[model samples]
Target: MTTSFQKKTRSKVLQIPGAKPSIYNNQLLISTGIPSLDHILGGGVAVGTILLIEEDTYGNYARLMLKYFCAEAVMTGHSLLLASADADPEQILKELPAPIIDDPGKGEATLEEPSHDSSSDNMKIAWRYRHLPKFQSNTSGVKFGHYYDLSKTMESELTQTVDISTVDSSLCACDSKQTDGEFNNPGYNSLLKTIQEKIMANGFSTTTQVEKRNILRLALHSIGSPMWGEKGGLTENEMYSPALPRFLVGLKAILRTAYACCVITVPAHLFCDKAYVRRLERLTDTVVEVDSFVGSDKEKNPVYKDYHGLFNIKQLPCLNSLVCNMPDSLDLAFKLRRKKLTIEKLHLPPDLSETANRSQEDPLKNLKPSSGCGTGGRSNKLEF
Candidate 1:
């Protein structure tokens, strides 16, 4: 005569190292290796997305960012696949920046420092603003990213813990019988195939036989440059080639069904056609461009004297929802200090000092009248 009910149990999600659920949508995300960049990217990059970085004029800062990505993989016990045509992947791995560990003494020292402004302690806050929350660069409960010391190289023992695979496009041979079409370039074809194989063989795919699952971090450096045999945007006739775009399509397809993410740096400054660049931007999930002021006039200007380059966010993808994660502010700049590369909201130092001579001689009073001013003649100098 009695009725019984059974309790339904929910499935537990597996926790992966170096990965965390996004605060906004609960989607799995991985850090880009730089803490500030991860904050700018809205709690790190979402899994299975492509991050396209347009190389700066000198390609120095872009390359440094790529190194950070690899260093994070090493520290977090994630798999890494580095592909490049110009430089050896082994060499790149050897130059990863050392990870910085937090020290309790340093924190205590900072807290014990005296305040510089005496009146700041007595300043009053409005009632409405007092209840507002303080600003934070990272809002996640878990620490997903680590800070790196750019001046030091990672120790070899720590780097050895990571499983790494490298693909050198320079060593790949092209097929003589292949026709010109999608993935026409042999390097592109080989790179795409290598990525697919790595995903399947390493159990990074969704349907894998392996028991434990881990994320794969792929970094492709200086793609679409002359060394990759893509014409480097030298001529207008070759600007619209479908090779790079088609390759990206395949790469994106591979990432969607696998537990992998990619960061690719392209020499976008070489491409002359705006439409072709636009096409490339449309194919990627996230697009960021770096404009370095190394040898330009901005390097000498006091406004940007503290910054090495500008960080521009061109596109951000919406994952599992209608809205995308937008950063708090777009006016951002990056600078390299002695030990770290940091991205922060661009702000100029306050010029508090008054001008030495506020009142000066007027320009009109300094001008003298011409000799023929009264005869309706064109005078070179005149007085108002």
Candidate 2:
């Protein structure tokens, strides 16, 4: 659309490391690991961004997305994941799709066979005989990330850890000398401190090695749930508690500096307050709401018989960030089928077949009436 298209040099957007960027708005996309979803996002999510997904009224599909997001990180070489939901680390590992060794029809090519031209011994310091560049005739199969099987995650299946930091503890150890005020800061939670330290250690720098930088995919499921130390409702004593807000703000700050992106799902319906939801929405880079078609008759439905739930983008990412410039309003619905999970554009049900049948029979009825009439038809109203 612009002169950038004619430029001979390739943009960073065109050469994202692990996967192919979205074809729509290929600025700086982070593959979501879902094909239809990546297309919906105009390639994928933008790096240095936070996506807050509100669970459906039924609280069904959001968890699936959270699991897939984590699984994708594991597949795309971003193995260090910070999961803060009811699911345990083992359960999370199990949810990740297997490496594509057995299937050649689709998925990533993980097991690339070694060439037979290597020497039996190590080559010593020799003359100036350089190897040729690899010949690439086909560029069709670019795997962005892996997929996951349908999983049943349970609260009891895995023991959820509160102090969840998926990095080395020694790297983030506190200093020997520190003031009481510094130790007692509102953002001084153990989890937050550890993540902030890790971000600083791996953050992008002019002198730092970009190839070695670690990308962390953080997933926070139901943040206000019991796992994160929530005390009942958001009124009275609970209203004054600043634990969740402080942690989220600190995490946001951390993401901005590090090679990371986050997908968080919160049970917004439980709060039952517009102010709290809006406040949470304000803190995130993007916000989406999901809901089920509880009242609609599934038997009569046509367009979305395969759909599981509906989704809507509430707030778009701000223009100042590295994220893609996505369309403000988007309509989407998702469905789960066997090993496949899909999201598609939401649409109204198709027209009824009975209407078409009625149209076909009406002409026959009209002809019979005219044939049975005498010389002139005596009409109740004016003849047309």
Candidate 3:
């Protein structure tokens, strides 16, 4: 006799929008908030995977993706942002996209109010059809998400734990234990250690109470820069510095045990040797490079004119067996708009609008062709 799994199965949900996999899978996937990107990453990145976005040019594009990831996480109530970049953590958090609001003004659709009258409950289904019941799901699952504002300052509770660079000795094992259960604005290794502590504390709560699981969205911008004092000119602080590998190793271990995901953008070329960068890649699950590999020349193509940068997904996320919920493949395109940054599948652009065709008054189209050497004037074909 086979038992049915109807009642025991819970909805596979990420804590917020553009995060988490599905409503009924054993594996957990978080949506990246960018619809196209989330679709590509098999239903958002797996929790605990470190996404490394390497810089191709000035590194501005990489920074934008990092910001988008953080903004989405924030919008969905995953507010535990751990920024390890040289930039101001507060500024980064403050620059996330504004929360999407459902406006009921100007005759727009508003949420329906629930009816509390007892008379409505009395109208029940006939007993003849009781064996086949319909599933009525609640649409309020997204309500638990928090709204974030880019223009305003974050509240005290919406936290940011920034761990910029510092000498490894400054935060040795002795001082780390004394960090008072908080790794706020500490050194490199300290941040990883703190994250590990949080992961261990949560244990496996993610697997059981999946919906209520709060994920950590860590944005470590520019791991090696002069501001942090890691760069020492002409040697990448003499082979991967003293703190980077240790930090990455500890962070990877924590991710394996935690209910969190990380997006760390780094210019490994400037800071680490080839082998060092490989080690970082080995530790990470996804690696993306943002550059003009597809030709950023605006004069040649219209797509280049619209798109700001080219993206290459060097690595795909590691997911468990669940084919229906995952994407077919991961081919992506990126566009940076005045207000938004989008990453979508590389596709042919839609044809120009009819209005645009009417707007363009072509001077050459209506002009008659002048008589030329091989044209209507005369056939100048002489046998030689």
Candidate 4:
């Protein structure tokens, strides 16, 4: 007689708040805070990758994206590490947009009207396509992301709930010898070290087992700019420094085995060398660039009047697979609505106005047929 053996059950995956499994690769993802952006970036940014944002010309829109990132963290109860040389992290945290809480009563009241409108709208489309599922920019069912009110700052009481850390590059102690040895910039080295320290201290490292697991969102603002103690990469003749690239490598290494992710905004437009920018992009997991039309001729053009800027996705990471999640559409634009920033498929306004339409007279009809060209007309004989 042999002793009976009991089968062991598999441990359940830790369910972190504000995070969801990606549809593409089943990796856990956290929102970038902007729902449309989260949609563009598959379900959301993966927990252990670096997201590089190429800043818009004035750095305005890029900064706003960073704020959205941090605001999402605050709303979801994730820890934040905000680093910046140009602005105080405290001030940036104070400016985070407040989360929009939906009222159940209001939703129920309007549900009938929206349903009617939707049915009518579907009826307007072709019968073959009417039954097709509607495309949603954000993930459906699970509340993985939340809408934010750009006009309102997050309440003080709300911000105090999450653990927050800051790294002010300006105040960081710099050792010239240390800077020379690795990363090439004291500010970069300091920031990297701070991030690594925070990961270990907060039990975010993969090896650190804790009772509760949460994501660490690191937001670095305006890196590679002059304020970070490096030549801002604006001049054509300036040699490319390996500092930023090295820092990214170190950062990637730190994140690979940790329960954290990072969002970095670089003044990419300021970088004169295209190859240098490419090198930086190669180092990051995901790359997006904001091309704002603020000071350009596009601002005056009617075709782009509806959008403030173009949103370009240069790269996406392949997590746990050979193929990465690709967005349905590549042409996208961003605009600031009354209360929030929105990213949508780039579309031109209909040509209803006479200014955009062609003249009433057909140009082809107005052209007289050449008398000697057609068989109906006689051509003059050439002299031999």
Candidate 5:
């Protein structure tokens, strides 16, 4: 335990009276849309920071909480960019807040490009706000920029887009033939190849490139799960080794293009060892853990079953949420907070009373022991 003397020393160090122009940088922070969480983060997320959200027993709740940020960004006119290597965007958006403006039905928004006769200033403004075609098919050598437009992305769906700057299009490792098989078995290689090609062809920037109109909240979901790979046969070592490097490189490129970056990762339990989680944590600037809680009949909850008590967002060390087991999340949170982290009760929609009541009848009926981690399920872990 830290003694009173050590606490005073630490506080003194943090509260040093400033001398003229110290070169120390600012602490990065992201808001959880909750007063308590924002307070814990020291303010809102620092500019150009990537926040990782992860959960296992309450994984769905974890994703739901992230939507709060996305909804806020959209309402504030930030262009939300969601990219998942595995899960479908539709599912992810369901847990998020609804969009402010619904553009018809098909998720498409079309705007006329200014003619060449238009002034250069007009083009500059247009480029800043427009949702450019960011996906491509590298193996087929087909460049499909501007071919598709997202007319509507529900706040709940998980978005999948290849930003084209981090991917190597020429070295296509994906095969497009098989559809009903595993992604790591060569079926989804074409998509990965396309993503890499787009990243390379689009020209990745190492320096921070700023844009005022397009504050793209980029969410690169689940990057290392072999389930998302298409070539198969990759050893655990091979997968874990490149996790951080690729993330770092991708993050650098993302910072250059978007105003904000949101990276969602699988729980740390999915990894074969602690080292994998460590590697993933190195790339993040802000980490938010999706903490699950038991339901209390005396209180109301969100409409969604998983939303029962998801408001408990915990901070992680190294700024990455690796929720494999309880220990990992707690460990990460403790490190990130640099001390004991306290959480408040998560508030949910009042309309969920019926659902909450039914769920409480048989809480663990649907839950099974988590095979990857010793923490078991949220039903058995959290006390309401």
Candidate 6:
């Protein structure tokens, strides 16, 4: 016979929050700038998350994907800081979509309000493209004229301007005067100085406070390159002077000054060197891998193309390739199947637009009907 105390002390099963995956509080996840790809990346990338992309020696313009994010941030009233370790800004701008290089007012269609209807959205897109400049600009001397104002009524109007100053490099890192001994990277220091000069030219004070109204997006490309291999540098330990650490410190400093951060990298070649990837991974909240390898499609179309559409992956060594042959939206799901590209719905966070309704109803019910999250994957191809 057990005593009363012993009965009370019976083993109780522990009831705790399931250790399943979920979104975090205070995390600002933004889109991958690619609608379909964003779903795979857990609903765009969380702000301040570090994104990695791998490019082979073939010199693919991997950075073009970044132009999408940069354009999105600017349209939404964010100031962007882009750091390019090896490429020239002008060259990078050239390969991007013409609309991205054009002013926002002239590029994007001005919709009075967003609609959930696919037909309406396509109509608006067509109208905007119709209004875009037909002939490219020939004059080298372009003026920095009045552009879109976030506070004005014309904020939705697209402009035709190409203001490099808007994407200047100098506005990164912390107070230019204060020096952390950790900022021992010489290449980073040089790049920082160039970036600083550009920022100052654009009328930014080195120590000026960046307001909450502006979401600041900063990207450090090719953060750790093997070209600057650890060998033949400073002493074994003192070689903490490449683009990676300074970028880490600079990114952290900006987080306090800005509303958000976006860091991009290419690790396939450099990161394989064990030492380089380990160092770069230390400075990130989230890491997203953007993979661009879509296998050859010789069966559907006889003509060959060097490149394929982009895909975002969890990156356990080329897992992103799973969706390379698929279309980005459900509307194209049927067409993509004809072309041989597959479609897969992925789990993601609640849409920000549905926040109010979500709060009033069961959050689980907010899932979109056509949303691919629960569906098994399918694929198709584009026939040139």
The model with the greatest lDDT is 4
Higher lDDT: candidate 1 or 2?
Answer: 1
Q: Which stretches of candidate 5 lie over 4 Å from their true place?
A: 1-35, 98-213, 230-239, 256-258, 293-384
Q: Candidate 3: give the clashing pairs.
A: 11-23, 12-22, 12-23, 12-24, 18-31, 19-31, 20-29, 20-30, 20-31, 30-44
Candidate 3 TM-score versus the reference = 0.58
Positional deviation of residue 283's Cα in model 1 after best superposition, in angstroms:
0.7
- Which 10 successive residues of model 4 have the least lDDT summed? 375-384
RMSD of each: 7.1, 15.1, 13.3, 5.7, 20.8, 19.4
Q: Quote the positional error of residue 244 for candidate 5 in Å.
A: 5.0
lDDT of 4 by residue, 1-384 (tens): 876887787445569998888878778899998877888888799999999999998999999999999988888999999998878888998898888787222453466667755775767547667656654343434466776777789998899999999887565445434455633677887788889999999999999999999999999999988777656543224566777888899999999999999999999877768888999999999999999999999999999998999999999999989988889888989998645577878987888865454668656543444544543323345411
311-352: candidate 5 lDDT, tens digit per residue: 334443332334311221222121111111223333234654
The candidates, ranked best first by TM-score, are 4, 1, 2, 3, 6, 5
**Model 3 CA deviation exceeding 4 Å by range:** 1-19, 22-25, 102-186, 198-212, 232-243, 269-275, 292-303, 321-331, 347-384
Least accurate stretch of 10 residues (summed lDDT) in model 5? 137-146
Clashing pairs in 4: none
On the 0 to 100 scale, the lDDT of residue 234 in model 2 is 48
Determine the C-alpha RMSD for candidate 1 after optimal superposition of all C-alphas. 7.1
Residues 176-225, model 1: lDDT tens digits:
23434543677888899999999988899988867788999999999888
lDDT of 2 at 177: 34
Query: TM-score for each prediction?
Result: 0.81, 0.63, 0.58, 0.82, 0.43, 0.45
Candidate 1, residue 296: the lDDT equals 82
**Candidate 4, TM-score vs. the true structure?**
0.82
Report the candidate with higher lDDT, 2 versus 3: 2
What residue pairs are clashing in model 2?
Answer: 19-144, 22-43
What is each predicted model's overall lDDT from 0 to 1?
0.81, 0.57, 0.55, 0.82, 0.40, 0.41
- Candidate 4 lDDT (Cα, 0 to 1): 0.82
